[model samples]
Target: WDGVSPDRNFTGIENYTQLFTRPELFRVFFVSFYYLAASAVQIVIALYFATVLSFDLRLRNLFKGILFFPYLINGVAIGFVFLYFFQDGGTLDSILSWFGVGGDHAWLGDPESANTSLAGVSVWRFTGLNFVLFLGAIQSIPGELYEAAQLDGASRWQQFRHIIAPSIKPVVSLSVILAISGSLAVFEIPYIMTGGATDTSTFVIQTVKLAFQFNKTGLASACAVVLLLIILLVTWIQRRIVPDDKVDLV
Candidate 1:
């Protein structure tokens, strides 16, 4: 955790070269699929609720508070809570049993399900932030546009497609950026819930393990740098694809 240790001293470039030669390096990317899945789910949920439910201020506030509450809770605590929820005969299993499924299934114990469970938790926790962002974007659309659309006998779906979506293109782009970066950097939930076990290990968790657990700070630094570059590269690519909305002042 500190640069002061003599044993942790090593060249990051060399560490990078050495680390990539190992076969387990690809496992990091494999586990990172969870992030991709969670981000997509979050975006869809955020948009749906923002568009369909934003008009009901009282109900919207209630739902927002409930959904956003998870984000307010400490990451470590969230991990613990979900860990118990997914444990054998725990809340999740109880609910599943009600639906006549998940009989004797160990959600976190199974390599196949562990990362997925973590990803679902990620969506549950972070979707609320995006919901608010989309909600604000929706609210900012001028009432006149909706009124005009209404006069034209435009359906709600058409109004959303033509007016709401175009007006909030910038916010959507911003949400995509945040979602991708946040997903790539995910660490705490997986760390506390699974301890990088059962193939639920992520890039950030691996970096932490290399640094603190193995005292390979240089290699860990290399991993951190690689992850940072991946995020930057992906963000750059996203921006290129969905350039920011430009306003004409002239």
Candidate 2:
């Protein structure tokens, strides 16, 4: 409400200072590492799973349901789930204790590990959606092309290189666009899990903090506009770089 209120006073630090002017606000830049890493890992895993495990309809459906279920869950719930899992002597520690490591490490306690841990959660949560998308794209490629490649003595890697990758280029582009934008706009996971503390704060999380936490509604509004512009600019650049033309399945 304060963000758009015309009568609201614009004074002091909130009025004159923008995120770009404040060096401390630059912390969110580091958070982008998590987003980029998670997106890359998710896309690779999705492609691998779609290519290999998508042959059996029944099995594929079951696996897809299990993997995609996390996406259906509420973001706050996911945070709590992972919070307990990463806590000291929790699920992660219990598993690591078997290998004589991480018995005393706090996954969310350290600045270095917090963002990485959050990124891992994001990967686990969203990989299912990416998996389903890549699976559909792979399945859309005509089977006759694979049969022809097989007759020509083309190995699986060669077939993927000549057929699958090119044929699904458009889908891959779409996935990349989605991944980039979604990563930029990510909010709830970090917000709920760390409350933007421990260096896990993201762009969106900081925006909310400025508005509600510090009552810098005007600055928060500007921050949101900047984020929107960044997403649009990045997406436009991605489209310009990625070709939209369909590839020959043969």
Candidate 3:
């Protein structure tokens, strides 16, 4: 859409068709799937932590601040932190070395480990967001609900299974949708870590590569359009599954 004047033809589906035909697309799609899956795992872990923290516990503010610190920092900075940790002579590698388990390895550089390494960064950086979302949902639940459940002789786990699970379904669904969309568009972290390596390149990264590196604006536009549709479809499905309360409120 930039610097094209009126000279270029609008090829419509041709560009989109090329997205499937292109070889580089494999890495793009894989990276997107990897990101989404890793993000889901992170969100689940955060929600669990949030649930625990929701109890009347000491040092709650301290715990919350620690959990959210990563998100407050630059994602690229966090990526570099993980990069150093994954690199040889870094903290994690030193820990591994101490255990007599494994030696120094460039986790972000290797093909097999690159995606995992970046996914770990993505997960850690955004875990705070999921934690807050879950915490909000947890606090919104009525105290009377828990009291009534206790009167019914409900155990903590059972109360969580019945009350918390049902009450937070919408929040869970929304988080899942957001994670999928946001992770699919991953760029900065991977770019900073591995420069869109084939094993870790995401759709958004490939879109930039296609447009700038290969001068394939048509294909890049197509990829972007496809990504948008995928996000919209997922969002629509989430809304359908979790029924928008806005309509009810209206």
Candidate achieving the largest TM-score: 1
Report the error of model 1 at residue 172, Å.
Answer: 1.1
Count of clashes, each model: 0, 0, 0
After superposition, which runs of candidate 2 have C-alpha atoms over 4 Å from their true positions?
1-6, 9-17, 56-58
Task: Give the per-residue lDDT digits (tens) of candidate 2, residues 133-213.
Answer: 888898888888888989999998897888888888898899999999888888998888888888888888888888988
What is the C-alpha local distance difference test score of each model? 0.83, 0.83, 0.80
- lDDT by residue (tens digit), candidate 1, 1-250: 2556555444536777877888696468777777887899999998988898766556767786786677788889899999999888899889988888857678899887888899999998998888888988888777888889899999989998888888888898998888888877889999999998998888888888887888777777878888889889999999999999753212
Write out the backbone clash pairs for model 3. none
> What are the models' TM-scores?
0.91, 0.90, 0.89
C-alpha lDDT of residue 15 in model 2: 41
lDDT of 2 at 242: 88
What lDDT tens digits, residue by residue, belong to model 3 across residues 1-250? 4335567877768876777777767446766767787888888899888888988899998999999888899877877777678777688888987889676777766766888778878888889999999999989888888889899999989988988877787788888888978977888888876777647777888889888887777778888888899889988987887784521111
lDDT of 1 at 109: 90
